[model samples]
Structure formats: C-alpha cells, structure tokens
Target: MSVSIDKTNSVVLSADHITKTIGAKNIVDNLSFDIHQGEIVGLLGPNGAGKTTTIRMIVGLIQMSKGDVKVCGHSVRHQFVKAIRHIGGIIENPEFYPYMSGFDNLKQYQRMSEGVTESRIHEVIKLVGLQDAIHKKVRAYSLGMRQRLGIAQALLHEPSILILDEPTNGLDPAGIREMRDYLKLIAREEGIAILVSSHLLSEMELMCSRVIVIQEGKLVTERSIGSEVQTDQVTISFRVNKTQPALEAVHQLNDVRVIGTDTNRSEIILQLKEEIIPQIIKILGDADVSIYRIEESKQSLEEEFLKWTGGNRIA
Candidate 1:
C-alpha cells in the first residue's frame, strides 16, 4: 500500500512554466509539473482555478500565451499532431450516438483513427470492463457504463497519456469507486500516465499517488497522498474508558503533542510514533484508564487541500 513517489521514473508529460493570459488577466500563471510513467496525478482546483485551461493547453485545444507543454518529448504547440498522437482524453462527459451499439460506436471511432484494429477495440473494451455489455445499444447503458465505454474508445489507440476532466461528475458512490480502481489498475498495468481533474477529494485521496493543486491559476502545492506527513511525528488517536485521564497521561509525555480531546467519544488525539504508544498505554494503565482502541488518524486530503488553497471551496 506504500505509494511513495519514485523520482527516478521517466517523465511522460512535462508542463514548463505554462501561462495563459486573457487581456489583462492571467488565467494560468507559471504553472509547471511533471507526470511520470505509471503515475496517476490529480489536477485539483476551485471553480475557476484554470484546471480546464491547463488541460486544454496540454491537449493543444487552446493556444498557450507563454511556455510549452511536451508529451513524450514532442512540443504540443510545435508538433501538434505528433504530440497529440500519444494522448487520449475526455474533457467532459464522453459522447456516443444513442442509436448506435457500443461495439458499433467503437467501430466508427476505429475507422476514424488510423491503426485502431478490431483486436485493439476488443482489447480496450475488456480493459474498461465492458466486455459483457459492449454489444448493447448506447441508449440502454447506465451513466457509469457509458463512462467506461468512453474510456474504452479513448484507449483504442493505446496512448501513452490519459487525461480526464471531471471524470466522476454524475457517478453514484459505487460507480465512483469502480472508476477509481479501474484508473489505478490501468496506470499500473499499462504504464500510462494519467491526469485526472475532479472535485471528489475523498476519491482523489484514495486513487492518486500524487496531486498538483493550483489556486488562482498558480501552483499552490504538489504533494504525495499517503505520506504528506512523513517526518518524525505521526498522528494517532486513542479511545479509552477515561478521556480526561488518557489526555492527562499522554500530555505528560515529552515527545507526544496532545492535539485535542473528544470528551463525547472518550478519545484523545495526539502526535507520536509506534514505539511511544507502549509508554502512553502504560501511563494510562497506571492511571486506571482502560484502552479500548487505538489507531492512526491522519488529516484527510480535504483538510490539507483546504489549508493549501486558503479555504477556497473546490468545484
């Protein structure tokens, strides 16, 4: 479950000091980051945080006012076709003809994109978990199923990079989880670099290994999800029979910092480590406090995201 980023991985997508100016306003200001092979990076921001603008620039849909975005060592602006050949994306909801069957829809796309063979279409269909329902008409498919089919179409050419914006917009909880797991599986199994833009903070926390957050069209922070706090201190929470006694016991320890006490739940939150837990428990035991349960409770991605963005609500 360790998702610590490996800096040695080859970079598949590079945005070098990209900026987009509209009249007197700077929509995106000097934003830069890299997405490596087999990595899933989340593009997070508020309603007007330039997430879409940045995606557009990378996919060559909009012209950049300054700087360049390169995919597989090809400049998006200079070599549009060559750069885009390595990319497959769904900016918004994926579209397919309601009258057409899922297999037929993919077949039409295969005709349009060169080298998208029948075998490749079948391969992508299975990749997205649509093998059983692929012959069904598009009108009968659920929103989640359509989303999967859309992803299948995008992957038909086996692009090196996958870009998705608001990918889980209308999905139910189960659908969201399914999409999250599928994306992670694809990134690991195929070594495709994935850039996902979504407002679902919890999903991103579980799915992406790294996230690049932007605020006011500028870089706010880039962080790894599970190890945001990898220093000496580790946050832990203890539920005990006596909350006051547990707090008192843990507060007396020199290394442990008592964050807060939840009297209602008979719990105490503190920052310490595995080795220190035994001492804390011993102190509690001597004080007649019975430990019911103990677990690590790190600050969620939503909490840290709000801190980084100055409480600006994400869309």
Candidate 2:
C-alpha cells in the first residue's frame, strides 16, 4: 500500500528506485519513497531487511549500486555535497566529548560546519529543552540529555531533513516520551522532514505521521498513522447487562462480525462500520439489554506491522 502524500507540503527527501548489491545478493532492492517537509516518517523492517542499508545509502555512508536519492532536488549520485547538505543525522548513539560542556560541544561542531551561527546553536539548545544543562559537561548528563544535546548539535546547521536510527534506544519510558515530544516539536515548529528507523513500533506509532514497511530488502507497504489513519471498519466493545442478548441483537446487523466475548464483564466485541453503531445501540435497547458502555478500539501499530510482515519480528 502507498501512503497518500500531502500536496501542500514540499517533498524534502526522495528515494528513486534505490538498490544496493553485494556479490550475488541484493541488500536493498528498488526501494522508493518520499518524505515531505514537517512530516515524521518511520522506516521499519525485520532483521536483514535493508533498513540500515537504506538509511546508509540516504546519508551517503554507502553508495547505492543502482538509482539515486534526492534531497531538495539535489541528486545524491551527481550532487553528493549539495544533496547531503540538506540533511543532518545520527546513525546510532550520538557521541560527544565527555568532559566538554554541551554548549562547547555544539560550538565544536559549529566550527566544522558552514554558516552555523552562535545564535542558531542557542536556538537548537532551547528547542531540545536543554537550556538549563547547556553549560554542563556531557559526563554529567543522562542518556536523554545527551541525546537532546546531540540533536541540538545536528540542528545548528539548519538542515531541512533530520534522520535518526533507533533514536529511543537505551532511553527509559519517560526519556522515550521526551525524545518523541522533542522530535515532533522540531518537525512542527521548524518544518523539518524526519526519517526515523526504529524497532519500537509503539513509539513510532505515536511519533510518526506515516510508516514505510519493508521485508527481505523490498518495500512491503506504506501507510498513514496517528490522526491521519482511516479505515472502513472499527473494532468496538459493548458492555451490557446481558451479553448473549446483546450478541443476538448485533447478529441481526449485516457486515458485522462478533470477534470476541467476555462473559466476566458481559462485554461483546464486534467489528463493524461506525455508522452501524447507532443501529446496534437501538437494537440492543429494543432487546431489553441494558447498555452500560460502548467503546471503539483501533488496532495497534504492532498488530498492523506483524500482519504486514507475516509475523516476522522487527529488527
């Protein structure tokens, strides 16, 4: 499945039939996708599915055996410098000088990068919520703080795209939440496109606007997440005083499947259209089944990911 792109936003990153081969094997085979500005797109796959290889190719760490990548219309094959200049990324753990202050570390990166002003450094530090610890040594920072500092350094150059691999790795629940919030803020406030590769499906569902799934080095599907997700049917649970009567009433409806039942709570779960819900409520009421609650539940990203990948564990 292909994701519906927003025509209003500019495409910042485009992978055009990119492929990577080694010896007789194709590690990344004809993968293609486009990430738009201000959108956070998740790249997902199982083990040896070329997620890393694809990311490496995009960042110019590894050359693609076929096709090309474009960043802001600059081709990676013919205009490496220009294409790469629009991107800032962290492959894995972001390293820093342990003894150096976070501010000084960003300054160190600023000296190596072109057109990075001191004000930009301060701006990113505040953007990542590290203003208070900006002057503290890196050694004194937690993993989450260091991650924020690394992001601040990457943003100093004002790149249009940000790429991160396993950005939430080694972070606690709170730290992961913090990272997700900061990334979303950057995407929304700065209008930066973000491509993130992570094994954390739950976090990705919360953080990304869309997801690109691949298996065996090929594209499996790409779909929207979060608020953009739409489906013809939804899973709903009806908690009533009489489960059997409620189930019987629901069976009268067309295109509705009774997926589960919980006699303990007198709940019956059914898969049906949202429009059919009012009819169900009325039918149950007519049947004299006291309706206590009606709740709609959507499938989690992990469930969808497993279905797409045929039960393969995400790497």
Candidate 3:
C-alpha cells in the first residue's frame, strides 16, 4: 500500500528547530521536519537518539526548551488548546477498560472529546475494518484488534495529524501487516498526515513514504522510500549462457564495474545505471552471449539506514 505524496499539499505538521533539554543534556537538539497531507513519515533513531523526546514535544506532552511546533498552522506553544485540538496520538500502548466493548470504549472517548458525532465513530470503526468486532469486549480482542481500536479512538476527534510511537511493538507478521495496511488507509483515504516511530526497519521500509533519521539528538538524514526513492546506479545481475564473453563485453563500457559473480560462473553482476542496460545487452548479443535472465538490485532501506547512521543499530 504505497502512497504517493503531492508536494503541493499543505504542510500538516511542522517541527521548526525544536529542542528539548534536561539539565546540561539536550535530548533533542534543534530538529526540524515537515509532514505533509496524506503522507506517512517514519521517525527513526538509535536508542537514546531523542525520537520519543521529539514526539513528546510535538504533541505537547512536554514543553520544548526552545523553538516551536505548528499543527495545521496553530502554534503548540502560543495556542496550546487550539494546537492540541488537531492532534491525536498513542504514546506507546493504547489502553482500554477490559470489561468494556470496543464500541463502548470509543463512545467514552467521544464523550470526552468535543464535537465528535456518533457517525464519525462508526466511520472510524469501518475505516479500520473493525465493524465485525466493534461490539466485542476489548478483553477478547487480539493485539491487532486492540491496536485498531486505539487508532479509532484517536481519529474520533478528526485530528489533522496522527502521531504513533512503536505502533507495531509486539505482534506476529500477519498482525504487523494488518497494522501497516490500516495506517496507510488512514493516510490515503482520510488524507491525514501520520508520523510514526518504530524500530522495525524492514516494516518501516514497507510502510513509510519517507523516513526522518536522527542520531545523537541531531538530524542524520531524511529519505524517500519505495518507488519514490531515486538512485543513480543499481546493481544489475545478468545471467547469460556465456559468462566470460558477457563480462568482457561489459568491461569495455565506461562507468561499469563487475561487483560479483555466481558460483556456477554463469552470472555476472555489474553496477551501472539502468539506462545503459540495453547497451550492455547489445554488446553481449554481438559477442554471441545468450541472455537468460536479468535482475536489478536496488539498495534496501536497511542498508541505506546503516550507511546514513554509520553502522549504528537502530533502536
């Protein structure tokens, strides 16, 4: 469920040079990024890198030592009531009364929040695909179901930005996929800007359109994911009937290097641009090398994360 971001969309959440300090230590130092409408942005950092601190500041859970956060053009500092009205978040795990039904839990939230109609409650339940289980007591709900219920509670307010911390903390593969799918649904169908913090790199790679990486309380990099990510060179594997001739033919081309080969010596892996692939095929064909298959290997998000963080393991 990859969603394309329209750059023209207005910024929904902005953290402008926000910093958090405790005594002499700066937990989050001057971090800044903007999440646009209909975008799912991932917040990534190694342990103690201020990801949670940054999130806390944005949601107004804690005051920023310096700078400001604006949600839907309302400053969180100057307008706490107005700024917080446009935010819905689950800091860690979503809690519920075990005895209460899922629908009842949402009804309670609706009563606490302002201007949330009963229709909106039903809409969010269906949006998260929990219509069938909405009436079931939350004590009987699975972890995935509980997570969806939490999201529904958060969305009852129709917040412009949804902030989640470790949304998939403990779940099997299927549950993880379910959470990812529903989050994407919220962003695409509801057009809400979502900011998520998670340590699961592989899942983040699949779920997020863009990732904001931090290290030592500083900005490391911000990268686009999936089809939106651009790379000038890719590792291409060419399986041909005659590997030696294919290798020699590709060697004649400039800006191409042989990175690896198969154990059978029937495959040659070269690093070069995709546009020059046809040229390599033509050169191989002229040398009577029959092409069997071709594969282009783009760098995975995990690899890029490691590179950007200088091999620091993500927390």
Candidate 4:
C-alpha cells in the first residue's frame, strides 16, 4: 500500500493502518505511509482533515488507538525511546526559551537531548544559517528565524527523518524562500527524510519529492512527483508556413494538442504513444520548415497534486 517515497523507497519511518480516537470520535482512520531516507515528503489536507492528529501519532506524542508505527525499522510502541532515534519532530508551533540566547537555548536542548554535544549544536546552528545570529536571544529573532532555530534543534542528534507540523506558520516571502531552500539542501546533502504538514501546496510542490494527501483523516492520495516521462512533446515554429500543416500534424496523433501559439511562433503538446517526438520533428524538418526548438511538456507539480487529490473539504 505504501507506494510513494513517503512509504515505499527503503522506508525509514512507516505507519501501518494507524487510527486515533478522542472521546469516541475517530480522528485518524486507517492512515498509513512511510518516509524514506533522503526524501522530502509533504502531507496536505484542509482544516480538520486529521493532518495534525496523524502527525502527533508519528511523533509519539499521543497513543494510537489501532495499528502501529515504526521508526527506522524500530517499533515506536515496543522500543519507545530507542525507536525515536529514527526521527526528530516539531508539532504545531515550535517552542523555545524566549529570554535565552539562541546558542544558550541550543545548549539547554543539547543537555536534554540525548546523544548531542556542544560541537553538534554549533553544526546544527550553522546548518540552519544561524551562525551569525547564534548568540542573539530568541526574543530578538524574527518568526522565520525562530523556525530555523527550531529546525536546528530538531536536527541536533542527526536523525535520519524529520517530521514537522506547520513549519512555516509565520514567515514572509523571503523567509519562506529561505526555509524552502534550506530544507531542500538538508534533504539532499544530509540524506535526511523529511515529512512536513503544510497548507502551502505550491511551496510543498517544489520542496517535496512525493506527497500524501488526507481528507477527514482518511488517506486521499499518495503520488510520486515528476514520475512520468514522455518523449513526444515537440517544439515547432513556422517561418512562412500555414497553420494548416501544424494543425494537420496535430491531427495525425490523437494525443497531440496545442499548448501555445502566436502568429509566427507556436508550441504543441504531444503525448508519446507509438513513437518518439523526434520522429515528428524529423518529419517536420523534412518538410523544409525551419524549426526553432523542441522540448518536453513538463508537468507542473501543483497540477499533479490537484489532479491526484482533488483535495477539498467535503461536507
């Protein structure tokens, strides 16, 4: 059932048919997924979609009513503390000592967080781009900066996976860009798998390799980003030709359609079925028509997410 990187590719953290109930009302119902090493996975849902509840269960902050969770192959229930080695997480808003310097705050976290050290804290601070502001007190930090510090703390022990809830709650455009870049960098360089719950679907489309969408605590969709490879999208332009040849060529292939076109310049969308797009390009080239360029029609991540989930709230 775990098909995407969130649950399939050498799984680092996985939930097997997990359910959570509070006061006789089931909040999370039979949710399941896995997070793989070195992948960034996004969890998206509308309000009251059980996104938060599922996240809490992953972090072990709440007991699941059914099924089980595993972190890096260790059962979260059976191993408890030991299984936590596989992950680091921050739920909702991250908390820190407002009066303490970021360095001091990290130091405190270092003392409490197992298997962390002074040097490790420095490393994490640098990792989050907080090297220049390490000695600054949390009270002076901006909301975005505080989020980075929270991430630095989360990475203190160098866990294989990171789980975050609403990680970008209070950041402006610049801050959001910074956080997005930094998270992508860490996921690529540190080989850390990240699972983030967010309402920012567009941003997640750029940062995540795959996405798991939930609606009303039930799994809506899980899909791999940019997984389709088509060889038929062609670049075409007519120097002094009629639009009829282009129209005729499009009609030749049932999957072919127009993307954009102007008086002189034109683009076509073609899905490869029987042959490569290069064949079409060759045919057009043989017709003595000057070709400008040809390129594949790359699918927008947002479009894929929307298509996969159609993830609006249901009444």
Best by TM-score: 2
Q: Which segments of candidate 3 are over 4 A away from where they belong?
A: 1-6, 230-297
Candidate 4 clashing pairs?
6-34, 7-34, 235-294
**So what's the TM-score on candidate 1?**
0.77
Clashes of each: 0, 0, 0, 3
**TM-score, cand. 4 vs. native:** 0.74
lDDT of each: 0.84, 0.85, 0.84, 0.72
Query: In model 2, what are the clashing residue pairs, if there are any?
Result: none
Candidates 2 and 3: which is better by TM-score? 2
C-alpha TM-scores of all predictions: 0.77, 0.79, 0.78, 0.74
Decreasing lDDT order of the candidates? 2, 3, 1, 4
Model 1: per-residue lDDT, tens digit, 1-315? 011233667889989999999999999998888888888889998879999999999998899999899999999989989999999999978999999999999999998999888898888887889989999999999999999998988898999999999889999999999998889888988889999999999989898877888887887666665433457877777789876667666667777765444433466667666799889989999999998888886678898677667788898
| Candidate 3 local lDDT, 95-135, one digit each (tens) | 99999999999999888988999999999999999999999
- Cα error, candidate 1, residue 225 (Å): 1.1
Q: List candidate 2 segments past 4 Å from native.
A: 1-6, 230-297
Given candidate 3, what's the lDDT at residue 305?
Answer: 71
Worst 10 residues of 3 by lDDT: 1-10
lDDT-better candidate, 1 vs 2: 2
What does candidate 2's lDDT look like per residue over 22-46, in tens digits? Answer: 9999999888888899999999999
Model 1 residue 203 distance off true place after TM-score fit, in angstroms: 0.5
Model 2, global lDDT? 0.85
